[model samples]
Target chain A: MGSAPHAAAPLLEFHDLTVAYGGKPVLWNVDLTIAEPCLFGVIGPNGAGKSSLLKAALGLVPIVAGSVRFLGLPLDQVRGRIGYVPQRETVDWDFPVNVMDVVLMGTYGRLGWFRRPGRQDRDFARECLDRVGLADLAGRQIGRLSGGQQQRVFLARALAQRAEIYLLDEPMAGVDVRSQEQIFRVLAELEAGGSLVVVVHHDLRTAAEWFDRVALVDRRLVAAGPTAAVLTPENLRRTYAGQLDVLDEIGRAVAARGRTP
Target chain B: MTAPWLSAMTAPNTLVAAGGVAAVGFAAGVVGSLALLRKRPLVGDAAAHATLAGVAGGFLATGRRDLPTLLAGAFVAALAALGVLVLIRRFTRTRDDAATGIVIGVSFGLGIALVSGLPRWGLAGSGGLEQFLLGHAAAITGRDAAVLAGVSLAAVLVVAAAVKEITLVAFDAAFAAAGGWPVDWIDALVAALVAAMVVAGLPAVGAVLVTALVVIPPVAARLWTDRVAAMLMLAGLFGLVAAVVGTLVSATRPGLATGPLVVLSAATIFAVSLVVVPRRRQEGS
Candidate 1:
């Protein structure tokens, strides 16, 4: 299935995707096609299956049905071309690994079995750390870092993967404003370098300002397109449903930004 | 054949037993560190307790009661117990701790019943099977030591080869899986290595407390360093010292089993590290 008839097939595609946990469906029929390299934001409320969508695409969660394709191929065929940074809270910060060791892990996928990361890989990892402004903290144990530093470290590791398509789950969650700006700067650079950057984000204020395109999701896709077109008041009301406070704030953020939502 | 230098030493049998137990200790520490890092240290305990039944099963099946035959059985039992653990977690609503407890209870009880009943049933060569419960390092022959050392070497080599992958999966399994790394296979490899080390540890540390060999040194080593490679090496060194010291001490004092001595030695190291190291201060920062 490596050969797709259409040369311009979407960079990433979720064909009628569904995800379930313990036999309960959390995400359903998420048919989204990201056709270009852009800063794509998956905006949703709590428990709206935003994380599940990314996890399902990564095959971390059980996909009850449907399929995910990268570059018109199944995951195994194009895995190395895609990089992922899971949620910051998904790992133990106190694990016996320093920042450099964690970043070096990003090279593991390319290194394959039994091959150690060499000097070139180390140099590249250091460069990735530098990109996230964490070059000096490379020797510090991960737990010693603040929450923002930890998030940046995760981002650096993903950057070390050096893939064409980047999927980051809640990269800005619990991060300080400064670190948030640094991460977004790096993501913007990634986009400028002609890479697809899909971020699972929660805050609509930044989602409105940052992402070029956004998908409104609440278990199912409400709408997806250029950020201004997709973050419409009706879509926000539909996706957030009972969460009126969030909708109101988001509406104000959109209007204040003057994005013609 | 034993090493030329080892054979030339006084009391060659004791030296062999010590050497073999040392290797087993080193391997256990290395393997146990991985298990501890994986946050499934108790899984080794479950595999350890399940080994006795395997020993009994081995003897009953082959009736030879040789080290190779019995250890082969113990290895199978350890894997089986681990398999049951995976099955329970996968198919049932039982929590991880409860499932581990169940495996430990059922397997250890079955082992005790089997070993206790063997001699009573008039089975030949079953008289010494109970020694496996608490270990009988004194009974280790040159051949047994060689087999133990061989198994230990293989287990250590596997760890060395996969240390990076193991550390990767342990630290952040979600990232590893998302990057398309075979997290499940790597986890299974670690479980299998733990089982192997647990089975190899049976002759020196015994089924009842062999988990200590695979646990205590790594834990103590953790107190000394925050690096995985350093922790692994220190744990291995600590295990070797404990095993050699315990075996040698037990040799000098008749009627004392080597298993308790080894565990005590390891515990002593752990206790000292606990009190002496500034781990709390570092943790606070």
Candidate 2:
């Protein structure tokens, strides 16, 4: 595995990771490695466990087996260096917090417990909102924003973390074209600034255009490499339609028997 | 001459009780905001109902009717109910709502049975324990009122200190967890705060309806503001008004329990906010 002489450990590594919900594995033993800072994408169809992959890595969900490492260390050791943008629908938009309040959450991890955000944090959060083109709407109630604007607010929040590695789950799923372009551009800039941005996206066409490297997933890792190499017609078929019934049956059996089927 | 009812409202003991109850109301609103935003409003209900068992058990075990001992018992019961709710949700296939309902119904029933049976069994001094069922604020002494006020103040301070952490967890738990915040511990702190508020409220609002003290004001405040800090302040103010007004009004009536009046007062504010605050614009045009 060290044959590539003196290659620094991947920016993130998932070695034989298996994630489950209620004893049912959603992501199978998946070995994925992000060797460098890039705009990476995890593309899959509905129910393909794309989001679960990120959840497992972040310790949001229980991983039945395997380990996740960030910068050659466990997640707990480098949590401050990572940022996460959860799906827009995962939260109640009507929650009584403004756009700035939500974005300021990005700085909470760095501030640690019982510490309020200082002026420096606020300025950085405002700069992040500016990057996402929502500076003018910083005081608006998050629920009052458009779907695209809400998505951008989440992006801005993630950017406020000032993280070296960003993981976004479905940031553009319901976003308008203009907001999608804005989000992609910011992500591209993050990559240029030497931060690894891993996005869980489903749109195939845009996946081809946006990601520098992509992983095709369907309950398991199908193909992973440069976007051009991983999104071939055969890989797409395998990701969207290949061995699904068989995989489902095996997953159920494995869950029932408490072992891989 | 002032009316007899008006004179009753200004009695020294009654005024002291009202002040303490007001503190409880404010604290409940603040802590309850986090629970409401976290979408765990019913957790307070479960904890509130379970407090009855603790109140009765405290008297039974210690043979003392001190406010602190009774409330300490109630806090224990509330935490136990929450623990049972978590266990049921985790170990069994019971849905979240169903689990909460089970804890509420069963624990409250147990509490009611114990409270009722204690007096019938001729347990001396157990007669007044039933006042905790619907709350009788007039029964509170000046020292007990002071204790309630002090605890309420501490709870509010705790919420103030951890406002950012609580708000982050409430708004987006997954993101908070990913950001390496101790999500479970934060959630547990919120729950414990809710339990504390519930216990603090029991002397004024009663076990059966105490959750209202924690829920109604924050919800009403939500209608009037879009910012969390503003909502919290508004909720606290609304709660204080409801508690003070309810206590004073109940003082006027000879046979009134304070819990229903406090809840009704809060509900009235919520109804007014519903009519007064403009509707928020729907997204996406």
Candidate 3:
């Protein structure tokens, strides 16, 4: 009952993806396709490997099996075409760096290493910060920022990448309403720019209204299509009320809510 | 001739040793700040105790009472201990704290065993090796102080050249890796810097707890500043003050050890700073 994807080939594809932590598998036998420039959402319970899927795509986490492609090409060949913003909580805030310095790091992939960040790099960083509404706070230390502000800084760094595809993991996890609105607006603008955007989001209410398409994932791909159809009552019941004692209740609720239909 | 205290401190050779110890403190503060910020404050703790085995090995290998030759052996042993710690981490299921504990306890045991066995083996200068535990800076020659200053200078230079990379990796390893920065190598480089500073500090703080020489000043300086570069400079200044004062105080108490005195002074500084300096306010920028 899903509408056909756009005629154009998928910009990103994951083929028979499987990932494990230690010895046991977390994500298993997953195949996914994203076509055209759209806001694609991945909704799942806490252990559903939504973040792992993104990590496997970026070569950030070890994948036991699977092949991820960008524009039907291997990741390494199209490395410049992608940008990733990992979880905000993943970094130490107490580090001795300001917001602008953190954002400038996003350009390092294109600029390469051992070379100092130049004036052009600063200009690009400034542009990205301004885009995130962080222009006035560029010189401030990141530790001094609120949780929401730190998330915006992470978004600013990703924006600095200037890639055609952006992968964001829980961009709204701890952000305040204003910062969340700021991030969502930026994401909406990216989608409008002919960029393929995928977010591993937990908020079902927002996901329903925000995403044009979403993939409902548990240990496996439970369902996927437009947000409304993917988030059917049956899918919600199976996702939240399913006999998954290993999963957290909040994760289940979030997964159930992220459904569009 | 000056006042009695000034004249006493003016002894030309003593002046040189004090000056050298001050530089050692400066390098320790700089390197220690990096370690502390990286949350690896006690890594030097492992290197510090392991130097005892090296000191004994140095005397046994060269059959010399010369401080440099002994310290050279201690340096090699300390690096080797660090190597062993890495191997343990890679090859075993033991936790890092456990591994650090093993290196600390066993190497120190080996050092004590070797030193105590010296009398039975009729080895010359075995008795004097005990000075390396607490330090005998008074016994260190004018030339030795100059050597210490040279090593300290090299450490400062390394910190200056690699500040950007070191700061990046220390703050966020994953971000550094994502940026295609050599995160692991940068981390290893900082570890190497820490080792160099620990080795340089041995003649001043000695093997038993020279790690404190690196650790204490940075702890003191953290209370006073938020910026990393400023913290480094302040920590170095604190270390220099501690070293000079401790050396002077030890001179007055003839039999007192210089290393412990220096460390105690640094501890006093740390306590005062922690008490006096208010925690910086958090402002979400």
Candidate 4:
């Protein structure tokens, strides 16, 4: 698959993508193309399928029926090329690990099973941590870091993957203003380096100011385009001001799926 | 190897008790770490109490209290409670809190009934069986405690082998999945570990409240440190302290049920953490 040597390929392509938690679909008809590298935002109200989109796109969540291609191939075909930074609260801060250890996980995908992370892997992790301004704190316990620093550690782990596409789920959620700026700066640098960065965000203010393009989602794709076009009053009202019947239905569907047949 | 001190004042019993209790502490620390880190530290309380019915039933059926055979019954009972919990979550409109409460209240009542009624049924050797409800560790023979110690030790070993994988999965399941770690299996392994510890702890803490060993230590340790490893080690130390102190305390006081005594020791540890430790920063700024 790697031998195709197509550098100009679209980074991500989604066709009629639908994702469900139990049997209830959370994301529907998610047709989009992330061709050129850009700072992208996925915005929606609480319980909207914004987080679902990022997870499904990255193959973290289950897809009901759809096609998601990365660089003209399937997820397994280009696993190493994709990086994911889940929510800041996804990990247990009390885990018996340091920043360096968590960052090393980014290299695990490439190293495969039964292979210990060697010096080269360590060096890449260190460099990634350094880039995220966490080099000095590598040896410190992960739980001790501030929220922003914790988020950066996740980013550093993603960077350690040396991936071409990054899917960050609410990296700025609950973060201080300086951390938000710092996180956005890293993404901007990553975008400038020709990497696709898709972020799931709840804050509309940050979405309006930071993203180059935004997808306004609530159970379905309401609108997706350049930030200015997607975050208009109409779209914002459609996302937050609506009854959220669709999301309620989706949540029920999700709950039903976990039941035994 | 058999402990060789039976000739002394307490014979091999005291050595076995000390060594076995220490192992239990270490195991509790390790097992409790995952539960505590998951932020569901006291989740097993209901299941732990429910195991009493199963323990009594096992003795009634096979007419034996051999540690292994008895534990098999408690394991089944614990799994049954977990299954019931899942059902409540699915079928009833009852929230997780109410469901947990129902299970905790009803199951323990059933267990208490079975324990209290066993002797009236004219069952042989049922007099001492009630101790499991409110433990009497002196009721546990050296062999029984050894078996308990061995099981806890084996569980600690399994946790050690899978340390990296469990830490990765617990800390961030999605990232672990993306990295090709089998997040599901890790979760199963953790459940298995917790269940096994619960079963093993029944002999010392008894089926009525073994979950305390699984929760209290990790919580006490949390107030002392931030890192996962330190928390785990400290939890183990705390559990050991609880187990040893509880056992010794019961040893001193006649008619004090070791189970309640043990849980009280852990409760004391938890109180110390709550009062002496710094308060947590509230979630919303």
Interface RMSD of each: 1.1, 2.2, 3.1, 4.1
Instruction: Give the best candidate by DockQ.
Output: 2
Tell me the lDDT of model 2 at B191.
96
TM-scores of all models? 0.93, 0.96, 0.87, 0.81
**Chain B, per-candidate TM-score:** 0.95, 0.97, 0.94, 0.84
List, in order, the clash count of every candidate structure. Answer: 0, 0, 10, 8
For candidate 2, give the lDDT of residue A56. 94
**Any idea what lDDT model 4 has?**
0.78
Q: What share of the true interface contacts does each candidate keep?
A: 0.78, 0.90, 0.29, 0.49
Which regions of candidate 2 deviate over 4 angstroms? A1-7, A256-261, B280-285
Tens digits of per-residue lDDT, candidate 2, A1-261, equal 524324487899999988888877788889999989999999998988999999999999998888998888789888999988899999988888889999999888878888888999999999999999999998887878999999999999988888999999999998999999999999999999999999999899888989989999988899999999888999898888856684777577666668535
> Each candidate: RMSD to true structure?
6.8, 2.3, 6.2, 5.4
* Candidate 1 C-alpha lDDT tens digits along A100-160: 9999999999999889999999999999999999999999988899999999998999999
Q: Model 3 segments beyond 4 Å from truth?
A: A1-11, A71-81, A241-261, B1-5, B91-93, B279-285
Model 3 native-contact share: 0.29
Ranking by TM-score: 2, 1, 3, 4
DockQ score, prediction 1: 0.61
lDDT of 2 at B163: 89
Clashing pairs in 1: none
lDDT, candidate 4, B1-285, per-residue tens: 543322331445645675676678679877888876765565567668778888887887888877677778887787787678778987877888888889888888888888888888887787666667666666667777778788888988887677767776777878888766787677766766787787777766887678889988887787777566787788888888888777766665456666777788888988887787667621111
lDDT by residue (tens digit), candidate 1, B134-209: 8878889999999999999999999999999999999989888887778889999999999999998899889988
